[model samples]
Target: MRREIIDYLKFLMGAPFIKGYRLIGETHLHIQYYSEFEEFKSDHPMSEYTKEEFDQYFNENDTLKKLLVGESVRLLRQFSYLECVTIEIKSYDRVVVEVHSSRFILNKYFGFNIEDLSLGDNTWKSMFVDVYLADPAKRNELYEKIVCKFNQ
Candidate 1:
């Protein structure tokens, strides 16, 4: 099932554009692409909203609806150069999607109690520092070690 989900995510590589997304409570996220939709559910057991709060917010919040739907359209417009997507699975049902082009990168995280997205430039420094290393200091440390070992 994990492999299947990963394979499905590869479809985003050349997808025309992202349509929108739906958040059902806090457990399920449904993402609509140009041609299809995919669903992702959380494996953790925790609710971000109470039943009463959820009902009230869902019925009364235009901002929430606009947030989920409008963001996709806005993102598509902003990152017209996006050509490929790379998926990093932190855990079962928890994934980070890196969408990139020659000039920019957009990272979107989905799973558990988090749904976050960030955009940055596709620079070598950014890739080496942000994507590859969790701790920025490790890059210099690793490089020094590699150079010392290679010289031996």
Candidate 2:
């Protein structure tokens, strides 16, 4: 699972930038890429409409909405930023992704029942994994390591 997670992180490194991620439920995370669409800024015709009116117009106009969605997709694909990856894992106790100045860390925990079941024997084996972002100078030091890996 660690290797699989690493591979996924490596795959994400191909993108120009990671826009952000949305956590759906406890086990699924969707990571989006930063797109040129986000950088598009102009005092154009579209800017004339108020935010509420713009949303209402788009909501009412199916054809226009589809056209805009298609165009946004086209632009994202053109820049190779179209792909969004969803990471799903089961029985994960906790997953921590820490981003520091130079690197990031991906930590995955498993086997501990955060919510204990009714069964008498609730004790279970646990596993803790760490992906360090910064090189440790001391034996106990841990730092962010993944962001640097992505940046490289």
Number of the predicted model whose lDDT against the real structure is largest: 1
lDDT for 137 (candidate 1) = 51
lDDT of 2 by residue, 31-135 (tens): 443222222112233433344443332233332222222222222222232232232111122221222211011111212222331224422111111111111
Candidate 1 structure, TM-score to reference: 0.22
Taken over the whole model, the C-alpha lDDT of each candidate is: 0.29, 0.27
- Give the residue spans of candidate 1 off by over 4 A: 1-43, 52-57, 82-152
Listed in order, each prediction's TM-score against the native is: 0.22, 0.20
Q: What is the C-alpha RMSD of each candidate to the true structure, in Å?
A: 19.3, 18.2
Candidate 2's TM-score: 0.20
Candidate 1 per-residue lDDT over residues 1-152, each given as its tens digit: 23433344344422223334433343223454322112211221253433344333223333222222233323333433322221121222343222121112223321111112224444423433243333435433322322211110
State the lDDT at 62 in candidate 1.
Answer: 39
In model 2, the clashing pairs are 104-145, 104-146, 104-147, 132-145, 133-144, 133-145, 134-144
Q: Note the clash tally of each candidate.
A: 0, 7
In candidate 1, clashing pairs total 0
Clashing pairs in 1: none
Give stretches of model 2 more than 4 Å off.
1-10, 37-152
